[model samples]
Target: MASKGEVHVVHLYPLQMSIYGDLGNTRTVTARLARHGYTPVLHRHHPGDPFPEKAHLVLGGGGQDSGQARVQDDLAVIAGRLRELADAGTPMLMICGMYQLFGNAFVTVDGDHLPGVGILDVTTHANAKRMVGPVVLTTDFGEVVGYENHSGATRLGAGQAAFGRVRSGCGNNGDDGSEGARTGNVFGSYLHGPILPANHALADALLSYAVPLATGRPFEPAALDDAIADQARTRQIRRLVG
Candidate 1:
């Protein structure tokens, strides 16, 4: 994996809509990379603009239902390019709303089925209660802490998961089995906190996936302090779940 200094992380579709602290995910990712003395170029992409090429890492954040609807068309326009990049091994991390949109289609509350990018074999439907709370995810990489806030029910397809058992909270797929959707190096999750601040392990995995292409060296993940924030965030989640 390339060192952080050599990697470029782009925020896909940040302008029109942003849900939860999705933007925070971008900040967290860049911050972690910076700690290793790697300067990550964070690029924000919007609708109708040309996506940068051969990016090491790509990020997609959550947004409101209406915003999702509004962006669907724009996303469709660049869907081919995005898929091509993913197929070519460019790592992508998509959250909640963006995660669902990567599927074949989304069944909105109004019974409207909107077209999706179809990069993954998955489907999402609106649920009654908006799932909102902290989540504990366990994966081959390691455990991750983040929040889930959405009314979408996701069903994993043939595609792999970014992580194993979600362990806690109602994830986007409405199941507790996995953290998010993944295809090749692409990852999709409902951890609205952008999943970087508290989940160093997952962040490293993402970096690992991208940096290899940018630089030939293996990734050297920096240590993160989980103890400092554990009590506060865990207590809040425990209270919410209870």
Candidate 2:
């Protein structure tokens, strides 16, 4: 357990996974926490490691197909603990391959089914062609932009709340307008480019959940200057729209 004023963050599979610049997401979380005066104590977990005793926030990132396969068995071992954390309102941000593995299962193009943690009520089908490009989403937090590169087409189960509606680019699938899935404090998205840097509101929202959980009281983080991030987001949006 974290001491008061400190947040325990679990970074899962940082070594075997995180093929796509996904490790940057962990940096963003820590930076945001620092700006808000909370000390973020990171617990990095690799395959075969014991699950952390407590975590106010958990982060898992995208990986290549091979990387995904490498961590599947290890992930399954901790699936029950993850589900319990989600149910208990711990905040999580799972990206790309991790997002797929958070669901019921991910069916590969070769017709093999990779068992998932089943934290999200969704299923992913690996397609031959990848969906790679900038994506815009109109989420409850507002507009968010990021880059996506994945071949998994995920379909949400009944009663699943999408993280947002697609504003541009291929989302969960080229067909569905949904871009990601969210249940309580758990967020699963395909967006990369180290998602939080461009999506300040979403970052703050995650912090809002974590701070309260860590400190046992509500917290409203002080605003920080996001000028550079906002400028980059605008340029990306323009390029995607134009």
Most accurate candidate by lDDT: 2
Cα lDDT of model 2 by residue, 105-204, tens digit: 9999899999999888999998877899989888998789998999899999999999888889889988879988998999999999989988888998
Please report the TM-score between candidate 2 and the true structure.
0.96
* lDDT for each residue of candidate 1 in 1-242, tens digit (9 for 90 to 100): 44445678888778655667788878877877777657688888888778776578888888888889888888988899888888988888788888888888889889999888987677888888777877876666655677788888888776445445766776655554666777788878888665776666677778877777777677766776667556655665566554
User: Model 2: residues >4 Å from true position, as ranges?
Assistant: 1-4
Q: Report the number of the highest-TM-score candidate.
A: 2
- Given candidate 1, what's the lDDT at residue 52? 76
User: Given candidate 1, what's the lDDT at residue 157?
Assistant: 71
TM-score for each model:
0.86, 0.96
